[model samples]
Target: MINMGVSFKIPNEYGNHLSDILEPLPFNYYQWLINNDEIHIVHDNEFTNQFLFDEDKIISGEKLYEKSKNNTYYMVFVTLRAFLKDGTIKSVSKYKEFTESDCQIILAVYDCSYVIFWCKNSQLVSKMYMYALSKGYEDIKYITEEELIKNKYYIE
Candidate 1:
């Protein structure tokens, strides 16, 4: 079963670059997404006007279509966790980014078991990743585009 989480917008300035997570990337991040073959184009549009206030971050319609048409700037991140039948906790955090109006940054966390998704555009996601790594999440694995397309998890 896949647990979903809320999608959040984050500023580019806050998180450590994806490059920091995995270096010698096969093409820059943007290029990697655009070139990927299996990504299912489910919802692509301008997410600009969906917000009534800064606190209410929602993607507007115009930008949505623009995303579908261009297919260039959007990026996504995902993480998956596996658990033992005996009640051991296993989790992974995957993250990504896309261009949004009034918001240049994005962040998200998906807790599958509780069906909880929390997202905030603050620099917190990147900070949290860094913190986790420092705390010894050394086995953290970066997903490739092929893997992302095969397991396209969206927030419904």
Candidate 2:
């Protein structure tokens, strides 16, 4: 069974250099994902007005892991699908940048601070919450499907 994921206000303090949660979380908090999942960059600020926004790009986990780990940059949203033990990647929507869909993982950030993550896998959310708590970001909050629809973080 799946549960509604969680949200938190990522600390945006001076000297924090919080470029985006994707950066810190990818390396420090959720590194395991790189090896286990195929990453899809749903949308990004740097890719504004580019095909990356319009087309689905299924990037290999190893490739992304090599490039993004420990780096500080901004990513608007990303969806992840696991590479199963049998070595086949889980299928996902051709495009789910907007309107929630069931993917293995969904990480979305808005205003460079507020984040909402809903994953089919609840353990991932639990670990993410733990990461936030460990970093003194204890404001992780529950979000309703209604709030998600209203927030429209994916919409400009």
Candidate 3:
């Protein structure tokens, strides 16, 4: 397994505020999203996986649009379906077209497949739970700090 040794610093205000509104999720990616400003949102697209990694880090969707050259606007919420494996640590996907300029690389490890959403707006993180529920996603909850410290290998 590759150890990236990345540590995330989630602002106390952001974490505390998000927890109150959004259901606590157990997925590591969700925890990472709460802490980090930019991420690669990946999902299946027919025969291959499609990835959308932010070109630049921004605090909100408005900032993202202002900074983007294309002015592309992403929805406030999105879903990702990925196949994760233990001992497999890859910062960039072989099949996906991502580079250092595209996003801040993150590391993850898991023993089973999981589905989660990645968002940019901290305030809208909780709203995703309702969207997921409407879309039929089951058992959506937030991951506690204790659980994150115990199970997650990537500290940031």
Candidate 4:
């Protein structure tokens, strides 16, 4: 399995506020609409909202995107799905702390002002990567799944 993600510096010209981190997650990642089931907003840090605690946060991606895109800081759990040896499932009963060296884990640190633009679809991955690169944003860097899993790149 392959995971795709990218890390880049948000130039002051592009706006430094938290919302700026979302600039790369535009049309290429699929529209912020109701029809697409390909995406899901699995977890977010709104304690008051019950959905944030659901094991499966099926809340519409469009709605969540609209609501959380501008928040200065918010933690998001983008699918805790993991695989076991026999092609069986291995899911955690509760959210546990994940370390950088852990294998096959997806972790995004919110306090750092970073968002992982991740996807499993190769075609979509390629499209997003190329699109971000094409934007000519300064300090934009690609993070291979290996790099991400191993914590090889620095966003700052």
Residue 148, candidate 4: alpha-carbon lDDT: 49
Q: Model-by-model lDDT, in order? A: 0.27, 0.44, 0.29, 0.36
Q: Residue-wise lDDT of candidate 4 within 1-156, one digit each (tens)?
A: 354655543332211222333343432223221111122223343223332223433323344455446332333323322222233333322222222212122223223333344444456456656665675544555557676466564321
The list of candidate 4 runs beyond 4 A from truth reads 1-3, 11-58, 68-113, 134-136, 149-156
Error of 3 at 154 (Å): 5.2
Expressed as tens digits, the lDDT of each residue in 39-87 for candidate 3 is 2232231212222334432123333222322322222222221212222
- The global Cα lDDT (0 to 1) of model 2 is 0.44
Candidate 4, TM-score vs. the true structure?
Answer: 0.39
Compared with the true structure, what per-residue lDDT tens digits does model 1 show for residues 1-156?
121222222322222222232221111111111111111222244433222122312223233233334432222332222122232232223333221112222223222111112223223334444444553433333323344334454322
Q: Which ten residues in a row have the lowest lDDT in candidate 3?
A: 8-17
Superposition error at 116 for model 3 (Å): 3.6
- Tell how far residue 56 is off in model 3, in angstroms: 12
Which whole-number lDDT from 0 to 100 does residue 51 have in model 3? 22
Model 2 agreement with the true structure over 74-117: per-residue lDDT tens digits: 44343444332333343433224323432345555455456666
Give me the displacement of residue 70 in model 2, in angstroms.
4.8
Please, what is the TM-score per model? 0.23, 0.48, 0.27, 0.39
